[model samples]
Target: MTNPERDPESGKLTERYSDEDFLEAVAELEPASTREIAEAVGCSRRNADVRLRKLEEAGEIRKKKVGNSLTWFSVE
Candidate 1:
């Protein structure tokens, strides 16, 4: 399959999924966590959290509690 997004020179994901990229990843994954996305984006979990929250507010992501911590996922 073709990649949804990638850096032109390095040919790696430039950052955490854009809204569209996150949607693509979520479509391919079960509910995932902020840390997971953060690692994939090559950023700090805290930074990912910020972007994730923005996505959530835009109705691109959904957050749910799993045990003491919360995991974020793309919504239908």
Candidate 2:
């Protein structure tokens, strides 16, 4: 899969991404907390949480409750 490209002007991503992109982002940040995943994927924490839940349910990743927060890890 092609990596998302960054905007030439602002240097931020300007394209829409698929769930696969989010999965790749999560894998890049394996053992990442929700916030870290969101930051890495350029998504809001709430949006990241929703996507993470789906990924977890699909067995693409794992979410472990650590203290008061959840940490995500790549299944691979």
Candidate 3:
């Protein structure tokens, strides 16, 4: 695993599942909210959301709607 590519325009490093650091965080704290994931990864919720969405789209993760919030989990 390696670092996610930085956004060329924003100059911010975007979170991605392929990132070693992000993957380690997720392994320890999945079935978590975007906020939790962001905290664990030391990223913004917006950045975590972006990565989570990508994982969901890639079928690597799944989300369950709970009340008005969502919890993410790794696909098993």
Candidate 4:
């Protein structure tokens, strides 16, 4: 599934990320927060969180709560 959006300023199309993108981001930034993953994937925190949860369910990744924040880690 492709998430495509148009840039208001440039009036150009942009490609949103997928679950795989989030997974790669988590691997690259292991032990990162939702915000960090979202920023890296160019998506919203909520979006990243949802996909991250899905990946977690699939055993592709895991998360831990550090104080008030949830940090994600790659299983591989």
- In model 3, the clashing pairs are none
Per-residue lDDT of 2 in model 1: 27
TM-scores, all models, native as reference? 0.63, 0.73, 0.69, 0.77
| Root-mean-square deviation per candidate | 5.7, 6.4, 4.3, 5.8
| Candidate 2: residue pairs that collide | none
Expressed as tens digits, the lDDT of each residue in 1-76 for candidate 2 is: 3356899899998545567867887788877899998887777899889988988999988988999999888886
Residue-by-residue lDDT tens digits, candidate 1, 21-59:
555554555477777776666557887778878888988
Write the number of the candidate with greater lDDT, choosing between 1 and 2. 2
Q: Which should have the higher lDDT, number 1 or number 4? A: 4
> In lDDT terms, which candidate is top?
4
Answer with 1 or 3, whichever has the higher TM-score: 3
Full-model lDDT, candidate 4: 0.87
Arranged by TM-score, best first: 4, 2, 3, 1
Report clashes for each candidate as comma-separated counts. 0, 0, 0, 0
**CA shift at 36, candidate 3, in angstroms?**
0.2
Compute the lDDT for candidate 3.
0.74
Ranking of models by lDDT: 4, 2, 3, 1
- Supply the global lDDT for candidate 2: 0.81
TM-score of 1: 0.63
lDDT of each: 0.68, 0.81, 0.74, 0.87
- Which residue runs of candidate 2 sit more than 4 Å off their true CA positions? 1-15
- Model 1 off-target regions past 4 Å? 1-17
